[model samples]
Target: MNLRQLEILAAVVRTHSTIAAAQDLGMSQPAVSNSIKSAEASLGFLLFERVNNRLIPTPEAQVLLADAEHLFLMRDAVMQTASYLKAGRKGSIRVAATAELSESLMPQLISRFLQNHLGVDVSLETHRLDTVLNYVETGVSDIGFAMEPYPRPTLDQTPLATLDMVCAFSAKSELGRLQFVTPVDIDQMPMLKAGSGSRINKLIEEAFQKSRVAFNPSVDVRFMNVASYCVEQGVGVAIIDELTASCRPHTAMRTLPFRPRVQITLAAVSSNSRPQQRLVKSLVKYAREEISQRLRQVSKERSLKGT
Candidate 1:
């Protein structure tokens, strides 16, 4: 029997009344009755015995119910999957990000994204800044998050925020007592800087040069979390973006605005050679809004603290 006949058969067997099954199936009682007759004729067997206006399933019909239940389950799954796909909720997004952002920003953003897109899965990879850009450029990753990635002809960049540089140090450090830390304040202090050649590092160098202070750093680290940890240990004062400082709020670490007001762009990088998938587009939009909201919260907190 066809699926329609099988549906009516199961409904009739379940409700034990054509009128009730018809109401459940949104069909007239006669139409349900005709469907049952057609199914019984096609099967060359009696599927139900009618007695006293009640339908009882035969032994053969009971066996078919078991298999029909499976079929109905599969049908429901297919329909739900189709609906999720059509609504841009079913898909996997691959992201490659620099270690700094992968640790600090992407986790919160991905958690928020997952809460909304229940059927979506995320794959996050942490790499160096250059490798992150390469992953997006070569299409190995759908998107990459980085701080001010260099302009590339093969990639698209979505600016999320322009974050100011902040000085991270132990709360007990003398520098923490100041309203703002400058290159001059940390000129001779042990300084923890990011790896050489990074965009933020370049900006930091420029700021120091403009201030005519030595840009020498006592240590070089690859990730902001590590730098924050060192600062918490009272190793040195590190200059990091506001995003990372805000995210890694170690109780022993305090951040002060670093002057001469060095700023860097936090951006989402993707391949420009091909169209982004709908899921990727939605994620980018969500990331933008989430970052903006977080920045506002940070600002409000800073304001309340008179910072």
Candidate 2:
């Protein structure tokens, strides 16, 4: 019914515990409970189900929580609009990114953008690919940086860069002697799986599935960084993203192209409904230019090596 109650409900959903939400809100547990109770009474339904003191938000609560988030963001937008009016060029751009972008590109792009647009504030939030897309869809972020193929009906996507996943090995490994890793070699070697859940692995899975060859994900890791670490420890070789392989902290490792398959893409997206803001436009332009240059440089290196 009120902003305070809506905020408390949203917090409870986010933290999944009343105690945690209370701590986060810097309020007493009793006060937080009272706010939720008041809100539920006003709505005439139970918003959350309690199981062992943990607040499991109901499906209806999920809708309300989403609405609450939108309302909160709308409030900020109003204030930002006022600031923009007063200062002419003062505002902020917020971006949500998945691993491919957050790994390094977003930070590098931000650094470059700030040099030219010093008056604009910038912030970034990293999340799963789906989560980042939703942030853009909801206008929670001015832009979303993610690895595609993403399922987005209401957003406009622009290709920022294309990424390739290649076999990486210690220089001492036999595979390191080969110019490229062939499909038959992958079948024999203990192929380091990037886990079935990774954004980049979706394409890899599709390719392997079509060929009727199993990926053989031995260790199911939750993070790409962990997979890289495992590869460094000689646990297994990794078919990691080009950006990941290029920046990986391993002097002894060499990345070779996967012979017949393996590729991913990085894309920048923004909601189609929201008209472009100056900061968002500037960021997209900067990212496109920088990423294109990097891609061209890599292509040239590959061409030279072909000779």
Q: Record all residue pairs in model 1 with backbone atoms less than 3 Å apart, i.e. clashing.
A: none
Best by lDDT: 1
Candidate 1 segments exceeding 4 Å error = 1-89
The count of residue-pair clashes in candidate 1 stands at 0
Best by TM-score: 2
Q: Every model's Cα RMSD, please?
A: 17.2, 4.1
Residue 156 CA error for candidate 1 (Å)?
1.1
In candidate 2, the residue pairs with backbone N, CA or C atoms under 3 Å apart (3 or more residues apart, or in different chains) clash, namely: none
Least accurate stretch of 10 residues (summed lDDT) in model 2? 187-196
Candidate 2 structure quality by residue, lDDT tens digits, 1-307: 9777888888898899889999999999999989888888889899899899778998988888777776787667677667767888777898898664576577778899999988788878887777787778877788988766466689999877777767776667887667787555666556566536665677777766766677676666654655676777777776777666654356667668875576777788999998988788889999888777766765676667661
Window of ten residues with lowest summed lDDT in model 1:
73-82
Question: Candidate 1 residues 133-186, lDDT tens each?
Answer: 877876667799888899999998998889988989888988757889888888
Candidate 1, position 234, lDDT: 84
